[model samples]
Target chain A: MSTTTLSKATLSHLDWLEAEAIHIMREVAGQCANPVLLFSGGKDSICMLRVAEKAFRPGRFPFPLMHIDTGHNYKEVTDFRDKRAAELGERLIVRSVEESMARGTVVLKSADESRNKHQSVTLLEAIEEFGFDACIGGARRDEEKARAKERICSFRDEFGQWDPKNQRPELWSLYNARAFKGENIRVFPISNWTEIDVWQYIEREKLELPSIYFAHTRPVVRKAGGMLPVTEITPAKPGDVVEDVLVRFRTVGDITCTAPVESAADTVAKIIEETATTTITERGATRLDDQTSEASMEQRKKEGYF
Target chain B: MSAIENIPAQGNAVDNGLLRFLTCGSVDDGKSTLIGRLLFDTKTILADTLHAIERTSQKRGMEAVDLSLLTDGLQAEREQGITIDVAYRYFTTGTRKYIIADAPGHEQYTRNMVTAASTANLAIILIDARKGVLTQTRRHSYLAHLVNIPHVVVAVNKMDLVDYSQERFEQIKADYLAFAAKLGIDDVRFIPMSALNGDMVVERGERLAWYDGPTLLDILETAPPAHTERAEKFRFPVQYVCRPQDSANPELHDYRGFMGRVESGELAAGDAVTVLPSGLETRVKAIELYGEKLPRATSEQSVTILLEDEIDISRGDMIVKTSELPNVAKQIDAMLCWLSETPLDPRRKYVVRHTTRESKAMLAGIEYRMDINTMERQPAEKLAMNDIARVSLKLAQPLFTDPYVDSRGTGAFIVIDESSNNTVGAGMIL
Candidate 1:
């Protein structure tokens, strides 16, 4: 028999990824005391929601749905977020950074600064408020450098920080979710998923998502070679020329920081096709806050940002 | 170039989706480096990660950032420029996403590879272009076949070291093809590429003009997902028991539910299922998840089921569809890959964890030790670390299982050393 013909018995790559993800999701629900699905209204989180539906559907979810609102989120996304959560009949809990700031727990460098890094403090507070032992996140390993180094059931300190150097050894499918009081585990269900996998699963599930994912004509100003969305919170500079461009957000985040990529691919199929050929990384194209090394994802995750 | 998708889109349907893959090869064959290249060239490696790799390489007095250093995390592995443990890396393309278990190639690390590829849908066995096929290659290929990874990609790496010769590539490909045929590996793809210099990896190479096929990532993105919907039986191993704590909620307080995810196949609410090891039979009354009831529970879903009759069931008990009961046996023969530094003791008893069932297993006998390089099985009295041999185990109790070749989730098990609690070896049922 031909060499090519002999390999047909092997399981395809995606089947393995799906099975593992499903297994991890079930493990979290089985082991943890109070687990909550952390939704960001992004494609990855949307994929997590679908996986959860497959994992624990036909019945109410074992845990509630939650989001750590930055108070700088896109209006379109947060609006859709409320609607989607209501439609699913699942509890949607929002712990706002604005409330944390008011309560003197979150201090900013400036009044108009991006609240991306400060999200950690608010998240830790929310975890404490709900006494959630496991916070199920949509963080994928393929997303960033720090995330790549994390365990699927990443253990967090009582302070809600991640120490990459002191992680537990995760071998085979045996994950250690053991922790003491005041400590919690940050469980990433789609840690194995890629950007393309998220989009494909999104298309497959016909999951209702925020409109920012698809390409649409919007008013924007070019800054640092990225199309910065024209928002009142993040106004354009004097020299920056505002223009109309058909663009889509590769990743959705706090509106003050998330940028858009130039594209006319208005549908999921188009997005999938466009994603295949794009050379720039997902965070590189859209997340303006991640451009610097000082405020990196690792630092944010270390400070308790999911 | 963007319109070159050739694989069927499986994840486009609600019922069909993602595939998981693993990679195995010899230590110096660039398995870790190849995975790093795939992640980097695919743009899955973030800029910050590249910067970190660059810094670490500089500290190690290397002019070029060694891609293998990204996976060789242990201090010992870094000093040796080899993989000592199974390092997992994740990435995605438009067509499919991948999670790779880059298992070490050393003889002692064979058990690590088994653990890595146990759940893998596909396996990529890297063969060095200059070295052609080595014993480690055969051993890894055999293990991949044993674990039943449905797809195998024979990536002929370091073609640059071989002058990009088509004859050399074809020769190696033919050798692999011949051996793979004997092992029942039907879906194998041979690709020629240089992992270090980026030849036919993410982009098509200018060198090797004779080759006409998709890049490694391209092939990966378009490869078909393994279809296992036709599994003969359904199994659900209970993980927990749920009963609401609130006294006010009377409807939930008395609702005793057996919680677990279906390991394989599908089961309807009224379908009859047999409890294995105990041999008791019952019918499903309702499939519940949280507070809602479902008509059915498919494989991989975490749903709690209420049986029509309250037959005794708990964790470690197998709930299999009555129509498809597996072979229940007290003793099993299997191919074992030893992992521990301490050699196997014939008199010792260890805990054998198969699926959810944990039973005491004693070493009955070692049949033979495999010479991976020569594809020879030598009769052995004892097995040492990294030795692959067929062994017989006398179990304290019967286990419900299929052959490892038939089903991975239920057919294989791990031997945990009782004293140290270390996973010493993995076995595939024969």
Candidate 2:
């Protein structure tokens, strides 16, 4: 038998996390028949894309890239999404809430209402149309209280509703990706990663993102202790005063509900420095729709929101 | 050694090492409170979370801010005021990052505790000071050891209720040591703490000056790193086969790579390896990680390896060092932790998933079920949910495996129900 003496290699926590994520991606590809990676051009999804590259490179992904377009999203994010997918030469599938609304599957209370929550209906319809067995997402457990209670391999019913009480037991690395027809599983490979970890990985990997993540001058109105971007979907109220300020988004969602924080951190290094001392979480400081108990994350998750 | 020497000065930058631990005990043993205190003292709790918990406490007609509300995120858990499943909590101090698996303390949730301990490096078993040691405490300790967690911390919580008595703490520690000795656990550390009063959890409470030892935070920071437990031999289970036949990238055509994460030990280029179940020999031609070639791939790194010789390999096949071939057998004697609601029936067939290999298996015979409380072996007919038993299984196909004591990555397997596709039990090869 031939053997070689090699020096040991020490891996950082981020390396371990990346390896675990790649393993999970491979497992999903090996197990699931029809799977799609949900990419929103956000930081988390961008990290997921990088992990997918490491998992299977020089070959096309077994699954396609998908986006649940709310139709109220920021132009920068959607443009970046298209460019990133095109650069990878992978097929991108975009299903919009507008299409669902035209079909009468989604009905908004007001014309100017945020279509973030309504994206779930469109998402479930897309899953039904595509016959996807698994939808890989970038949801982290440390993001919110409800997400923290979710399983890494969260199983969804035929209606795409989540039953947190009846989740399957995920022990060790043996995830049960079994789902009957019409039932899908939402796989979160980065469930163990935190916001800081994501940022650290981004900086280390030199991942590109939309410009809105960095500090930029933009017209915004202050409402509910958060800066709401002034856009056609969300215009200023009667007494609201809009101003230009240097701000950045801690999280990017629909332009109607997502808020920006005042920051001068322009580079990834500066953003890392800012995140280290930040006292407030990403969602608490930014998301407008999460301010009330009625629209709690748990309630939304039960309604098929990712 | 003086306690003050163990306590590092405030605001020291400790290495950002990762530590995963489980907190388990009987219900109402202050397990949740201890985790809450760790997060609160480490300054990981956000201002909004603190305010939310405070408002929830006030609405519930409580005098103090209930820290347990921070972890009990589910609505049903809040309504019942108990953790029914494992809730993972993440926090970081200047020195280290900790992942706490707050396992449910109910007796029936032993499966939950086992799930948490499966990946844990350390375990913090809470023992109520008022109650020296309970049956649940022993059960949690045994589960922790069974999973091969290297470190064990016996936290005597609710010290304030016992008047911060040193004698009481010593008595409990002595009793625990005696019990732990029977399980062959040596790295047990005892600390007296009050999860409510914040004594010796994060800070050194003034009342425990007479009892000199590192605080819970200090001990966690100084505990041994988890990577020291890797197996001594290289073990890699093939997960996927990567072959890109893109015409544009002609350099990659006909490139066959066996992709898998190194489960244990290390593999270097030119090292001879054997593909198990087929027993075919091959030498490592190259180790590629994301388009970059490396001299070696160590444990826990996912990489693609090209062999010198063409061999028949697929998913569920094992590629290990030729010198360290593991047991390839069809019959396995192992310890089983039944996890499903339905009891294990020896007459029925179940799918055994070992590493990436899946095969049909059935229980040959159950040797005995150990009573967790008394450590007694009792003859059991069927293994119920949360029951631990030593049994023999006959597999439809041979598997390459190591004993659970030798390598955790290669030794453990899960039993899945064929009809429901639910994981019904976990086994460790003896």
Candidate 3:
């Protein structure tokens, strides 16, 4: 440790976060018997892939990539998900909500009901099918209130339920990632990262994201205080005010439940600038499913939602 | 109190690295309000978040917008008006960022407080001004001290309740200082604040004319990151071994890397190192961070280390500087905080995960248990949840370790129940 090398001693905030996430990802590879990266082709998942590359790159990732698709997500995201996985040469496992519905494990309340919440069931079924001891996700604490209380290696029951009251007391970077038969651990490598941190990392790494993340012209209808993109599944009804507006998604989720905020920030650098000064939270701005109640996220999480 | 007289009126421009601190107190002490004020004054709270809490406060028929509601993250916590678990909050000043771990004080949640205090470089012990120093204040301070946090900021909150009296602030400061000294807590600072009135938190209000100390934001911003201010022995625990056998690339053919984070101290590319358990000495050939090579790496930065000579090393192995080796032992005497409701069963063999190493440990003896209120050691036959006790463990295999005070990275472990696979206790090596 010379005086000249002292300048490299303290890392920037993004480096610290990237290093931490890489550590967590390696922990999963070192500890878990069977693990899978839950990729949605979203920004957070893309960030996870970059960290996974850093953690075990030159070598293949210890686990494969899996997706629990809702069948109604943005085509750009699903297409990017497949493209990224193929380019990385990693095995990609796609388990669809439609397949779950075909198996009768997931039943829709109505023909037009959103398949957002039912992704949990399909996710659990995929875990059972693959016997994945750990599923690495990209959920961050800063996204919502209940998420802020979750552990880095969030433990779930045999039925994939999260217990909010009783969590493994995580100390230091030591993650308790042990589970029994039929049980699994959902690891959020970027649990400590904020939305702004994610964007800054994306800008630093020059990571690619789906087109919907940036501003684009889309046919959208404003309802319940959220701008829902007009898709075939969620088209504008008779009394709906449809407008071709410039918008970008704050969070990418199911088409029926996820909405986009009005934005013209098209680049990652612009997104970073916008996120730094934005007055709205990531979920509150675009997640229509979160509008029901403050505890809705908690309830969904308890039933094994990532 | 000592640093108060030395601090300038307008504080220094802290251009240091990131700082993580714990703010521990109950709801009544305005701990939430203090945190909320810090976030609000920093302009870190988004409009929708504030609006949501504002709507909730309006529903509850509160007047001043109930800033405390901002910190109530859980549904049950919001209903009961208390922090049930450790909730993380973030904000950034102009120079650096902050990560605040908000842990509860009212409940018998020593495990929660320990979780929050584990990674904190500093701890904020919030004391109600009118009440002076209470039992929980000492308990939380003891927890911070137990974790060996470098700094402690004793915030005398609710100063307005005492008519903004400097005498009241001094009395509480003296009272807390005595306990802090008894608990062997060094680097303690004090400030009088009214979180409800937004005084001496992020701002230097007009009411606190007698008090002259750096605000909480100032201290947090300027505080050095863990293992940065002092030079410590380097400890790198091997988390994973990267051996890529791809025939397509020549670089992947012979690559064998020991991947992990620099848990403490620092390491460079040409440093002499030793692999533990085998006790083999080697020199670092290179330090690979993704595609780039680093001349040196500091604590908390994950990197892949390639040795000059091929030595047998795997996960759970230790890579240390050959000059400063840690103690390797089979028996450990530790201060154990049992975190499970099932209590400790002497007949059960628990797994001790120290660093990356895992070994079976049997409870040898329970020397004594701590009584939180009395601050006394009592003889106990069995250990229960939230009980801090002196316990001896017999490990199935030897582990490379150090005293918890010397380096937290090498001296701490979590006890996992072999049957349930849950973390049963947290132990710090004596």
Give the Å shift of residue A63 in candidate 2. 1.2
Q: Give one digit per residue, the lDDT tens place, for model 1 in A20-56.
A: 6666876777667798998878778877877676565
Off by over 4 Å in 2: A1-10, B1-16, B227-231
Clashes of each: 27, 1, 1
- What is each candidate's DockQ, to 2 decimals? 0.12, 0.45, 0.48
Q: Which residue pairs collide in model 2, if any?
A: B14-B95
RMSD values, in order shown: 7.1, 3.8, 4.0
Candidate 2 residue-wise lDDT, B278-314, digit = tens: 8999899999878888789887778899999989889
Task: Evaluate model 3: give its TM-score.
Answer: 0.96
**Model 1 chain B worst lDDT run, 10 consecutive residues:** B6-15
Candidate 2 CAPRI grade: acceptable
Please state the CAPRI-style docking class of candidate 1.
incorrect
From the highest lDDT down, the ranking of the candidates is 3, 2, 1
Task: List pairs with backbone clashes in candidate 3.
Answer: A279-B47
Across B315-386, the per-residue lDDT of candidate 3 in tens digits comes to 999999999999998999999999999999999899999999999999999999988777899999889999
TM-score against native, each model: 0.72, 0.95, 0.96
Report how far off residue B321 is in candidate 3 (Å): 0.9
